[model samples]
Target: MAWVKWDQILLPYDYGGLNVSSLKLKNYSLLTKWWWRFLTNDNALWVRVIKSIYGQSGGLGCNSPLPATKMKIFSGRNWSQIINIDQTPSKLGCNLSNVFVKDVGSGLDTSFWNDIWIGDLPLKDAYSRLFRLEVFKDATISDRITITFDSPVFSWAWESQPTWRTEDELASLTNIIKLHKFSNNSKASWTWKHNSNGAFTTDSLMQVLTSLTAAKLPPSSATDLSPFVPKKVGIFIWRAKKNRLPVRVKLDRKGLDLHSTRCPVCDDDIETLHHSLISCKFASNIWDKVRRWWKFNQLHLTNLSDIASCSNPKLVTTLGVSIWQAVVWVTSYYLWIHRNNCTFGKNIDSAAKIFSDIQGKCFEWINCRWRKGALDWLSWITNPCRFDSIFTKNGIG
Candidate 1:
């Protein structure tokens, strides 16, 4: 049975792949949805069930026995102070400690100091001294009196006078208070701040969780391959880079067919992903012509890693990096297809012809998929290094 890597399978469709959804990631998103419902729909059955279990610690901690036990044992323990790797507390638990509020419509449901409503940050954390001196720490949004529209001002009632050391906190509070505008008609609710829409999303959750995995991964140089390149092309590049392509030699090693596992284009050596994509004489000829055409004479050609390194935006101008990465991808795609055609089909295109085709495909991909300035085919073919100039001429960059 063929199985795609979880990361590749979940890539966006435009990146030369299927638009399959990961249930695990979807379930994580649903957990946030449940939280949203539990916080906003106070009378719902599930909400009642949750409140019965978790109780109201006001974003301090849950009422679960495990957390309760951990809190009792590790109370006042700063996470940074824990030197033991095995005993380090999980970050997933920490995410629950901060509750972001969406103060829309009537802002009565949210607590001003305790909840992270303002700019997705807590007022207490931002203004600790002022928070400590506040008369009503748990004051609801409605408790902050709004004056007349002609003279809009918040009448804040503090428990103690501001001290000399609290000047910075007072300044920050003044700036934050001015920017507190409510979104009309929408209900006041709590949402995960990780998502832009104030809702949970699998993509965002996966990014966060993948970052926290215990095992460290090798540093990756691959560009943002999806959403720019076609899915078929992107998937092909991904498999080839991983050395998992269905080459005859690889199939033979896996106890499949045992005959004729030689290079299809060159007929010189064993046909592996590297030989077919880069090392073979046929592929090298195409790469040579492409380098000269692009005027990148000093560019190195060795493996998929080299190609990936070239795709780094930091190495080249940001405006042209996407198109440059696409060019490398399109070249790899053409080489693979040419090898397949020669191996399985009756006809195969020459290296020069394949290079020409790659150039055309690159132009089409950049123009069609590009959301920035419109690309000119003549300009691209003439000098791709000047691709950014087109955007400058049109005032579009």
Candidate 2:
């Protein structure tokens, strides 16, 4: 059974999720890139074929919508759906067109009023009053600009005389257009605003989509996790933080017919994620060993919230705190594994053996992933913090 909302699970790590990629969002990004290709690469054979079939006024998603006849005849195709891709039908409710930008050059290709080539929005949106008075809505940049006397001139074919409000909008729009410098030598180009170099990339687009759709969770539930341990361990901790770890009580709550809700390890209390990993008798013994190994004061960790504070920054340097975090999480991983073994009636390692095993595991991981190269088995087991002897010299030892 699903414990968290699918939308919440789709968020990136910083937003209380595993950063699982959304296939719908990914497919949308890919289709949007294809739309970019169709508009920018006018010489491609497929683009030429599409332009011929869809009518050249606007290719698919460029300016004007497809003609009413074609809209109904081929409306079932993916291309038709892509052209009208707006925020309303989107998975994350993000407007894909917001990332689409138009760069004007010779202006033969770009639509003057329909495309977002200038200002914060499309000219049709920014100057809607003036747009209502235009006779040709799909006119290109070249259609509106006339070069005479070595200077560019503006021309507009209005439906009729404009109201006072429409005249003011026309003047404002004209002044904004004058400030934009256009080149007569180059062709108009389309750009993905989410990326550099005006190119489209799935990775860049996914990040943009994540930012738009990701919901902010409470700070207590979300945290910036460390990369010291493997992802599986991190995922376990994340699930534990959310209290979704399939413990006996949680399973019973989910309508599973378990024999009992008591923790199988000690059979002392109801098994919740916190009780299974933090305050249980067997788990508490492992935590105490880890606490002393890290040289923290004798502070009891009755709550899972106390685990993070166990690695006191004042007791160890920043580097030492990172190493300590790895030890804490690795211990948590093995403790859960031992609990499973006990539940299944398998032989279990003693507490000392578990501690020794984690020491070796942490030593191998830290020595390889960390670049200091100052750690040895002897130093790690005794005091892993005394890195390069400089850490001890600083009196953090």
> What is each predicted model's overall lDDT from 0 to 1?
0.62, 0.72
lDDT of 2 at 270: 89
What TM-score, computed on C-alpha atoms, does each candidate reach?
A: 0.53, 0.77
Q: What would the per-residue lDDT of candidate 2 be over residues 185-245, giving only the tens digit for each residue?
A: 5777767777778788877877877776663343434554655677777777666666667
Which lDDT value does model 1 have at 395? 32
In model 2, how large is the Cα lDDT of residue 272? 81
lDDT of 1 at 307: 66
Weakest ten-residue segment in model 2 by summed lDDT: 388-397
Worst 10 residues of 1 by lDDT: 80-89
Residue 348 shift from truth in candidate 2, angstroms: 4.4
Query: Over the stretch 1-397, how does candidate 1's per-residue lDDT look in tens digits?
Result: 4635565555444332344555655555445444455566777775565445434321232222235554455444432121111121134332543443555456576667766666545677778888888898788666774534623356677887788878677877767666666655536655666777777554676555444431233333333464457978776776666666888788888788655989878889998888988899988888888777777755565777766545542235555666677888888888888887887876777767788898888777777776756777776777777755545335334
Q: Which residue pairs collide, candidate 2? A: none
